[model samples]
Structures are given as structure tokens and as C-alpha cells.
Target: MMSDQPNLVTTCTFKGKEYLVKMNIISGNSLEMSVTDKYTTEEWQCCYDANYIENITHKTGNFKQFDIFTTMLKSGLLKTSECVSLDLLTYDDLEMLRNRRMNGRNLCPSHSVHTNNVNSTSNRRYLILTYSVEFDRIHYPLPMEYCGPPDPQVLQGIIHRLEGEVERLQEQLKKQAEQYPTNNTSHISKLQKRIEDLSAENKTLSEDVRYLNKALSKHSNSMRHIGMMKGIVNSLQEQVIRDRMTSHRQIKRLQEEKAVLKQQHTSSETSCSKCSKDCFSISDSKCLLFTTKFSSLL
Candidate 1:
């Protein structure tokens, strides 16, 4: 129901029992009924006697106008803005309301009352008057049939069963959570220890790499120094070979000069002996000539 007006959920107390109901607009009218609960997955369908709906409607002035669930809502009981601030329907009010409207042939299929007994003449004529959707106003109608009231005691039993189920579910959840608490905590701690060990190993590997790099650099410098020394040694060896060859040439030249000096001394001595012999022969010839001249003078 589209309306700017606020809906009201009002509760009425009766006979120390509780029921929940809502008042909301449906098709431009107010509807008040027992609160709808979530459907159960179980194979059982919940049911209430039709007589209960008639008797309660006979008592409360509300929901008298419409017989069906939809019509009652359209009657506009919840249209009043005051309903917004009002509290939810009291359990008493909801029980009474449910007692009146929820059990008609429209909602429940198994009604046992005679059709003629439904809305009898005595039940009519001001049995209960409440707002009706018929003329968009209040309506008065008589009770038609009786499906017999709900056994309040049986309803209480159902509530008790539901409460027990809820308790069992809660206990199971608690036990399961307790069982694995330590296992989860220990698994997390082990993972943390493994991570720490891996980090330490990585640090050690990095240090080793740095040390190897330094050693390689020193070996490279030593190789370069050795290469330079080898070149210097090669140059010194070449210079020594050149000096030895020069000394050998000088010694050969000196030997040749000494042999020439010896040959010149021998030639000069032969020439001196030949000159003395010639002088002696000339003196003999002079003496012979002097003797001839002296004999002629005598």
C-alpha cells in the first residue's frame, strides 16, 4: 500500500496470552492480522480451526468489515499516522485478532462446521461492527460457521517444541568451535617460523655473493700485474742479446790489426841486412884501387 501515512502496529492484551500482529496498508486500506512467520522447510502445514476466527471477530470490533485477509488490510485500519509511533501489537491483541480472522475458508481448508451454521441470523445484526472495505467504511456482520476454537494448550506445546530445537542448535555450534581452536592457532605459528627461516637464509646468500665478487676482483688485478712483468722481462732479454753481438765484432777487429803489425816488422828487418852487405862490397873495391896507384908511384 502506497501511502505517506505511517502504519501502526497495536497490541491488545486479553486473558494473559500473547500474540504478535501488524497493521499496514494493502490496496489503499488498513489491514490488521496475526504476524506471518517464516515458513518451515518441514513437510508439515500449520493450521488453525475456522471457529476461532469467527469467535474473535465477534468479540473485537476490528476486521469486521472484510472477511478475507486482503480486504481487511484494505479497510485502512493502519492508515492513521499515529500508528507509526505505536508499539507492536501485544501478544494478547494478536491472539484475539488471530482468533477472529485467520480461520475462514480462505486461509484454512479443513473447516468442520455446517454451512448453514455459518453466519446464522442470531450471529448477524450487530454481532461485531468494524471498518469494512465494502463501502470504504465500517461494517457489521454476523458469524456464519464455527470450526471450533484453537486448543490454546496445544498451541503452547508447539511453542515449547520450537524453543527446544533452538537450544539444541546453539549447543552444537558451541562444541564445534571449541574442538579446533588450538589446531588453528598452532598452524599459524608454524607458518610464521618457516618465513623467518627463509629470510635468514636469503641474508646469508647475499653476503656470500658479495664476498665472491671481492675475491674475483683481486685475482684479476694480480693477473694484470703478472702480464706487465712478463713484458719487461722480454725487453731485457732482447737488449742483452744485442750487447753480446757488438762485443764479438770488436774482438774480431782487434785480432786482425795484431796480425798486420807482425807482418810489417818482419819486412823491415830483411831490408836492413841487405843495406849492410852493399856497404862492405864498396870498401873492398876502393882498397884495390888505392894499392894500384901506390905501385905506379914506386
Candidate 2:
């Protein structure tokens, strides 16, 4: 919901923490969250990643709008903003607000769904906000895109994850390079098998990189989750440095194999002009085998 007036704070309980989640809008272009834990009175500026938003909105669907999650967003989230305007509440107006509204942005779903006893109602604060958006501009707030600056230290986990993945790929490449393909009777089959292995490794590493990027892209999603991983990240960074050095040695080994293949190709050119066609085929296959391997591993 686009509030014409700036900052708003709402108290909420999520994952056992009672927090005052404050959202402030700076012009039409920015949104920032300042959260204060009620018990400890601690405050932090947070990051809410866009990919995580897609997971919540798509998986939860109407429940996202009808539940406490709805409190954070209008019906359409970053894609669209829709809100209802209501008249000011008189004291008696409070008696019926719950009965009249189902829009997700204004009221928490707990109030909407909790059953009442014979003479009592669920007693919770009813917040009704009236806001508007320009549909043509697509100005809905994207949490990370408009996020407030978070403390720089929050990035440690992401840096660790990236380094880990890069090192893992390097190790895999090093192992492949160790099994040098010689121009023997089994050379063709070995080269083909290595190509397939490298291709599969490339695909897997690419996917891992993409997933890590999504998880680390927003501090809001990672802050609570990353704190518990400090021990894990510390070990990973150390392993990455070792793998990088080993991978450099393996790369030199691959280069020696390439020089051997090129020299073999040169010798074959003059050895038998009668079998020139077969020699050319072998040369092309060997060149392709190494080129494909290097492009993917590097």
C-alpha cells in the first residue's frame, strides 16, 4: 500500500520474535525497513531479496494475502498496488471494521480468521490504511531494489558461499586434468568421456552459482539465516585458497598435453598423405575435445 504520508510501523510476531517492523518511503523511488526487536530493543536495517519474495508469493498465494504475510504487502506485491479508501473511524466504527474488510494490506489475517466465542471477539489492533498507486509507472516497492543500507558485515556469508563454489569447481577441473589423454589406442574414448564429464560439471556449477546469488542477493532474507553459518563459512574460505593453488598446477599440466597434441597433429600431416582424410578427422576431434573442456571448466 502506497501511504501518502511517510513512515509506518506495525508490531508483528514472526518466528518467535516480536518486532516493530517499520517501513518508510522516501519519495516514490525508495523504501526502507527499520526493525526493532521488542524484547531486546535492538534495531537493524534489513534486506528482503526479490527471489525470496517470488517464492513466498507464488507458493503461498491467497494465504499470503490472507495471513500475517499479507500485512507486509498489498494484493499484488511489487507488481501492483491496490488499496481501499475508508472513512475515518469513529469509536463505534471500530466495532465493524473487521466484518467489512478482507483486503490483505489493511488488516492482519489473524483477525480475519480467528473464531469468536459466544460473547467475545478477537481483540487485536485494526489498522486500515488508504493509499493509491499510479498503475502506469509500476512503482510498487521492490524490497532489495529500494532497500536501505545495511551494515557491511552482513555480506560475509555470501562472500564465503561464492568462494566455496568457485573452489569446488576448480577442484573438479583439476581432477579431470590429472587424467591426461595420451594418443594411444584408447585415446578417442577417453577424450569423449572427459568431455561429457566436464559438460555435466559445468551445468551443475552454473546452477549452484545461480542459487547462491539468489540467497545472498538480499540481506533481509539472509541476515537471520546467515548468522548461524559463521563457523561453516570460516572453514570454507580456508579450503578455497588451497583448492585455487592446486587448480593452477593442474592447468599447467593441461597446457603440456595441448602442446603434445599439436605436435602429434604436425607429425601426422607428413606421415601419410594417403590417409590424410582420417588424420584430419582425428585432429579435429582432439582439438574440439580440449576446446570444449577448457571453455566450460574455466
Candidate 3:
């Protein structure tokens, strides 16, 4: 029932991208607002495990678990606040909350709820609870105290196993040393040969690795060159299309001009024929004599 406010802020730099986070205050613990791209909320009651709570507390020095739990108890904000107020609440609440819902989830003591889509006005979904430290001190159990070292029986068993392994290794070594003593020149020669073989194998491995790396680099460069070539080809294709369009327009204009010249030539021929006919009617014999003379000259 506490007044809603932004409680915590978190920031992280991931792969050169900067992200900011804001926390919300609600019943007793902070809950992440899922509507934001920056921050994800987790229930405080869910992070009661030793490691989960510690990690968040170490990272965020605000709002400890003890503080939140106590606040929740005093304000009757816990799910079992009525039982808690009467001292009737036992460790079952912790067991149930841990085993049931909040087992693996981590809680941030200084997380924010001020992300977009939180719907702070009508939905009331962005609010989170911040518990009191006193309540946590009283309710949250401490880690199991270690009494001393392991039992003597376990220590004896471990030692026995180790001794057995050592004995077996010693026996094997003795047999090997006896079979190929330092005095045996042939054994030394074989050892040297084995060392040389191993060295050759190592060299081969190194060469393979170097060759693979070179091949990968070459392939990467080839891909880059191919991409560049594709871009150039696309640009050339566009230029070709533009040139074709211009040529098409020129061809159309030339065709129109050719049609106009053909029409003019046909009209001139028709006019000449009419004039010749009109002159022929004035004197058929003269026209006939003129045609004969013209034909003879042709």
C-alpha cells in the first residue's frame, strides 16, 4: 500500500550498446516491469536462495532482502501477513516460496519499474514491494554453519583410494623402467624417435591451423569482393536501361521523320503528274511528240 515511486536504477554496457533500468515500489518487494526493453522484473520473494539473493545484493547496494521482508511484515503486505503479524508464520513460507515459484530467479535490490507499457495509470502493474530489513533478519534463515572438517571415515576412504592408485602407478613405472632402463641405448633411441614423431605431429597440426585460417581469410575477402561486384553490376544494368530508353526515343523520332518525308515525296509526284496531264490536253500531238522525244532522250 506504499506510494508508488521509482526505486532503483540499473545500467549495463553490452557490446557497446548502453541500456538503462528503473525499479518500481510495490507491496514489499521489487518486481520487474516486463513492458520495457531495458529491464526485466523478478519477484523478490522468489529470490530467497543463498546465491541468487547475494548476487543481486552485491551488485546493487540498495534495498537489501532483510529490509524488504521486514517492511512487508510491518505493513501487512506479505501474502501471509496476518499469520506473520501473530508470529504464527514459520519457515514453511520460505520453503513454499522458494520451492514453488522463486527458486532460480534472481532479484535486484535496486531495480526500476519505469519502462514503457508498464501502464502505471490504469493497470497498477508497474508497482513493486520493498521489504524491511528487520523482517528479513528475523525471517530469512542464515546459511548452515559448518562445524569442522569432513569425517575421519571419509578422509580415510579418500586416502585409501589415493594410495591404491599410487601403488598401481608405481608398479607400472617399475615394470616400464626395468623393461627400458637408462642403460639401454636402444630404448633411448626409441624414446628419441617417439619424441621426434610427436614433434612432427605438432608441426603438422600447427600448419593445418594456419592453412585453415588463411583459407578462411581468403574466403571472407572473396565474399566482400563478390558483394562489391554485385553492386557494380547492378549500377551498370541501370545505366544500360537508361541508354536503351534514350535510343528508343531517338529511333521513334527518326521513324516519324521518315514517314513525313515519304508523304511529301508522294505529294510532289502527284502534283507533277497533274501538271503534265494538263499540258498534254492542250496539244495531244505536241504532247505525244514531246513524250517520244523525252523517251528517246531517256
TM-score of 2: 0.26
In the range 190-241, model 3's lDDT, one tens digit per residue, is: 4334434333433332332333333334467644543443343344334334
Better of 1 and 2 by lDDT: 2
lDDT of 1 by residue, 2-87 (tens): 12122533333223432222334444433323322112101111122335544455555543323463344323334333211122
lDDT of 2 by residue, 192-294 (tens): 4444444443333333333334445566656454443443444554554555455455556556887998999988876777588788999999999999999
Cα RMSD for candidate 2? 19.7
The residue ranges of model 3 lying beyond 4 angstroms of the native Cα positions read: 1-220, 284-298
Q: Which candidate is the best by TM-score?
A: 2
Q: How close to the true structure is residue 119 of candidate 3, measured as C-alpha lDDT?
A: 46
For each candidate in turn, the TM-score is 0.24, 0.26, 0.22
Error of 1 at 280 (Å): 2.8
lDDT of 3 at 295: 96
lDDT of each: 0.37, 0.44, 0.38
